[model samples]
Target: MKNTIFIALILLAGILTSCGSVKYFGIETFTPAEITFPETVETVVIVNNAVPQPKKPGYKYTIMGVEQDTTHMVADSALYDACKALGEAIADQPFFKDVRLYNDAVRQDEFFFQDTKLTPDQVETICDESGAEAIISLDRLLFNMEKDVFPFGEVMAGTIKVQATAVLRAYMPGRNNSMATIYLTDSLFWSEGASNLRTLDSYLPKPEVALRETAAYLTSGAYRNFVPHWEQAQRWYYTNSGTRWKQASAFAAKEKWEEALTIWQSIYEAQTNKKSKAEAAANIAVGYEMVGKFNEALDWAKKSLALFKEQTSDEKDSNVALLTLYEQVITSRIQANNKLNMQFGKE
Candidate 1:
């Protein structure tokens, strides 16, 4: 079975009506590219196109033109480290058979960080070497930093702003089609003060330190884009009507969800007045939704609407509009649940 999901679901979580207590759900954050590989595409190779710029013997470095001990070039393997992390993450997915994390070529002539697309020859070579069905290439992984140092009366202050962008592309064996690319970007800012020449010169983080920090921040959450993700979501439930309703609301607030549902069901079944029954039915529907029983919730929502019309048999009830709106909300929630369940729930 195939499932479809949209990134908009996360944005809609904040939308709510203040009729009752609240509940929670889990939803996917971003939409992934269309994955249309053949059934035999069970293996993938996550390769780093980035060339290793290992530090040379006794390489000198400087900060603000004042020789400092910031050798970001020595930490240049951070790209490879991030690639290792991505490979590990994919390995845990169980959807693939084998994965090769790296290629040991000491490429010294190419600007791998800026190359977004590999030549057809490069792609074929990588696949041939790894014997994988597809390849995920790190198109570019580079960071630039801005350093500003100014002097105060007896003290100096400095600010460092760093920005990093990582571009990734997936290549597979198939007839020609649009390949999927994942782009991630992040920016960081920090400042410090110094009182003397020594401190002033080293007021901010060293280049390697800053680069490592930025890489950690960038790669911390970047791998999620390549796989399915579940993020927390907030939702509201109606809980205001009478004593039993208030008690049920309190139970739900305490996370005694089953107790709350039982009380609401009692109120719904025992009430003889159409208005009271309609209100209770709406509460019960919300209860079902809290437990992820969206189909049942939808059915109870329809029942609430039927009772609401009966309550307004004389066309005098002012709550008719509110009940109609509540029914619409239930309908929309059902539709959202259908989509969310398909994406995150078991098939």
Candidate 2:
């Protein structure tokens, strides 16, 4: 009996120790609320105008070929492939909804020979013809096959470095005639190198798949970088009326922690309603937890609990659901604090 009891206690201690280990300490946390764009504001409509052909065009695409810098033998097949890939990439963007590719062989060949240069007049004509809100003109300055070292060590690696610049211009015909241009002077070098068992074709995949994957990557990266900016944008929309507070709640639903935090913080600081202020304080703690700031979370949780306690009239006012949630917060904090203490060998 004595031996069994001792073994049980040891096992319990082991269990506690295992529970205290923070394996994914900062990895996974609560997502902030969802963000819904205001329904009243209309989404901007955009379109892609066709590429203008040069006056003396031969091939459908003027520069549809791979040009060897050393030899100067242009490969027709390579150039066509590249142009097709670029057209697919541009077509995939949400901003370019309505797109029309021009089919003038003479003009296209001429433009290609001129290093894909398009005059402002040509761009305007294309925009007017296509009835497109925006025009994206593509030009391939240099498309060359080259050898490159893979970031991950690999033998016999090569790349197709597509060095081209594109210009995107937004043109409004009648309304103020505002013109906005963006220069896409970036190199998209795709490595032919693959893992030990994979080939270059495997790595490059189809243009559609590759372009979609790239779009997803860009969109995710942009959102991650723009979290703070989006939060600030939300603040401008927040007002004293319950509407802004409700908007903040909607953002919280979408797991937009930063925006929800900002709005909740504002409400906590500025709201006159005691209940709303307390709720905001509690939500701020939740936001901190989502961001992996456990210490700040605990502090805010304590503040919320104190406010809740002050607001409660008696045991009658403290309903079961509210009490349970409050207890969960306190219990979770205690466990977290205890685990932190144990990790540091605190007394």
Clashes of each: 2, 19
Q: Against the hidden reference, what TM-scores do the models get?
A: 0.63, 0.33
Global lDDT of each model? 0.62, 0.42
Q: Pick the candidate with the highest lDDT.
A: 1
| lDDT per residue (tens digit) for residues 69-101 in model 2 | 332223333333333444444444332334444
Candidate 1 TM-score to native: 0.63
For 1-347, candidate 1 gives per-residue lDDT tens digits of 11211122222223323323333344332223134344466677877765533443223443455655554344465677667767777676555677676565324555544454666666677777888878777767777666666665667777777787787777875425326777879888888888865776566677567766776577656555554444443334455557887898788777676798899899888889776787678767767877777688778878877887875575434344444554555565565554444444333
Off by over 4 Å in 2: 1-97, 105-124, 139-141, 148-162, 172-178, 188-347
TM-score between candidate 2 and the true structure: 0.33
What lDDT is reached at residue 195 by model 1? 80
RMSD of each: 7.5, 18.9
Candidate 1 global CA lDDT score: 0.62
